[model samples]
Target: MESATLTRPPAGSPAPSGPTARLHVERWPLIGLVLLCAATVFGFFYYPTYPNYDSLYSMLWGRELLHGQPLSFEAYRAPTQHPLAIVFGAVLSLLGQDGDRVLIAITFVSFIVLVAGLYRLASRAFTPAVGLIAAGLLCTRFDFPFLAARGYIDIPFLAMVVWAAALEQEQRRRGTPVFALLALAALMRPEAWLIIGLYFLWCAYPASWSQRITYAAWTAAGPVIWALTDLAVTGDPMFSLTHTSGLAEELGRAKGLSAVPSSTIDFLVRLDKAPVAIIGILGFALAAYLVPRRIWMPTALFLIGLGTFVMVGVAGLSVIQRYLLVPSLMVMVFAAVALGGFTMLEAGRLRTVWAAVAILTVLGGVYYTTTRVNLHVFENELRFRGDSRNALEDLLDNPKVRAGISCGPVSVPNHKQIADVRWLLDLPKSQVIARTDETQVERARRGGVAIYAANRAVLMRTVLIDGMKDPIMTQPLPGFRFVAASDGYGAYVRC
Candidate 1:
């Protein structure tokens, strides 16, 4: 097959107008259908059973809204609990079907949106052909399928960032819709806050003082609104922010900020299949040396995201590989641009070599997805969730336990770490009242709460070892009987 490239009009010619002209001039993402078909086929055979932990946390928020319960901000504010994803999960529940399938469907849709977003951004920055190739190459990377097979917010959040970039590139203006997409992304994850902040700074250079101020204000709005909402309910304006900060401080104090450099290097080695990571590195190199100056905006944005991820690690949060998606995306775009050739390789011999390489890279991705990662992700998720569900159900089925149990007190780290509270309590939100101090546990015994459940591990730690204190302040309280235990959880009912 011949290699494809965009056709630009001759110099001094007037820009073409109309939809027909646009179609002929721009490259469409023909590779998107391939991605769709692959995802659809994989989902049919290996739909995920276990929701990722953050995803389950978000679903609890959705469940809360569904039941018209108020969200408790003073409780551990799940960093993963974005309003949009919670809403998305709530909407998914309305189907009243098997939750596993609904979650699978969410992953499938997130894949499509991600591919489409990448294509749009590539098309705007380089060429439609480049965009198509970039999206195709992304589909082939080993980690992509494993991720696409689960309903992780990482992919959805990246999709929003890429799509916003596409719109900004195409419009050449800070339009309202673009800002809206960005705001949605920021609300979904704090990582996007880095991207949003960089954008505001970028605006300061070329934009008028008034325009910069307007964009800056818009950029600040999402976080401000989220903070205010937390304040309204929790009576503390900084509840969510402080929760995240406190976690970081604990982690930083224990692990030290030195962990950041190792985490960033680990990202380079493991974010994708080795070959794709190599290609991404090569793409970054080529973008700097060969691609047009116009591509610098995305390069800068990628660096900003990377720096932000490192700073997060410095704060003591574990930097997982998926956290690198924003930078990975820019690398893919750069790789696509590199593969397409800056000025389009001459026809015949060079074009033939280019086409061959593109086909092979894509085929490598297909083999990895079908033969390895898909089955791995599917089976592991099913096994993990099966055990988790068994533990949760064992607790829920005990006859003596009348109402849902408090997960325990708000201040304890283990309270947030307890496994499957969402499934155990059968409640809408993850926050059950906490019985942290002796007073709360006593209150629960005195008609305050009917039962309290904890992950077997969390229960052992809180009750036996730590006595629910930061430094083991007191002995375990009496009057609670163990009702049941399972592979992954334990329950106690007030006697």
Candidate 2:
């Protein structure tokens, strides 16, 4: 059918032709849907590398769960723990162990579902075919697709949110399924609580009276269940508070100041990595401008989702582009509706516009992913290593080592300091050093931190400003070591 592109075509314009001319014809997304799924898989699983440090954090939570560290709480409040990603990791552990491979597989699978969910979400607003079109655009974006490549929670959470939204579009007979999904969403990440909670309230206020009440109750159940479970297991209402608190303090991020100019610029830089980000953004703006007042209510759903992310996001302790995860999900849905309403000429035109966006986004994203290789990212969760994991293995197997374990920071989640503690324990530190303060280093390694990890710049800054002393000894790590040392990550052994 010709798309409903322009709100008001010219008065004498031939009442649109081709697809729009054939109004009696119905549109379905059978083949388009299959292609959509494949496209997402192709786009997301570009790299089969190791889980980033954040992924390792979830792995660690499973370990803690194995060691009786309740689900609601952990000794270390790493970012990867609270969400449903932890539960998935724990379940993976239950099914005999294949650490890296299994975890990577989970990440890959999540992306496929993510594509399918977007398709379904789009199907609701326009023809099912238009939903497929939206998925095609989304999979093409570099920033949105990578979450799929590594099975990180951001993509999974986005998938769940999309599904929840799609389900919201349908008429429901019960609150059970609704509550269950919200719980699943919350299980993915604590931030989801805000999104789903708001979703529930909206469902109740001004909707069908009884239905609204039911939806609100369903939505409320997620946090309530989480709270009860936390109390039962960890004696805390909000789990991961301690670690999360420390992380926020370390980063010096304000409560709701997500609109920082530098950080916003950083996001624009990240967006520049892919044409898809830019493409989809333009498509969204154009589509929104085209929408007639008649479709305002339907469009309202997408706009609300977009507002939720834009309003609450942009300021999380995450990489600038990754923040695009939430906003991307919201906009993609709107884009589908926006794309669906196009006139055939407009649809074809949008197709061209979005195609360019997809291609650009993918190329840029891939280039960034392949080049610029460093394991020092303090915010990204998916950590890849060339020799680091192996070097760590060799050190842990040494006979001379006694109670040797290294500790260092990669990223902070749950206000928790440091990265990859899960990897730290499973992989053990031979002798660790941190570039942080004496206080932080001491707390992280109360068991006796021997060797230290620091960049030359970190040392100079601490020495120049803080007036702190030196490490008893210093060593190098990976590409460039800070100073002369015995082993990687500055393995300091007790004499």
The lDDT of each candidate is 0.60, 0.49
Q: Write the per-residue lDDT of candidate 2 for residues 1-495, one digit (tens) a residue.
A: 123553334222233358764452233445555665575455334433456556766665666567675442443323524545666667766653357557766666666677777766555534454567667666655555555454467777766766765565443332446556766877766656776676666555557878777666666666676666566666777655445555555555443445544554455446433343454565556554543332332354445544543543344433335544555554555544444434323546666775565556546656865576343452132332323343444543554332433323221111211333335434322222244444344343343323343334323422222332443223322222122233333443321
Tens-digit lDDT track for model 1 on 88-148?
7677656543564577666767777888888777766665677777787667564665565
The Cα error of candidate 2 at residue 257, in Å, is: 2.7
Best by lDDT: 1
Model 2: per-residue Cα lDDT at residue 84 = 54
Cα shift from native, residue 433, model 2 (Å): 8.4
Candidate 1 residue spans exceeding 4 A from truth: 1-31, 34-38, 41-50, 62-70, 74-104, 142-150, 204-214, 248-256, 313-318, 338-343, 353-378, 386-419, 427-494
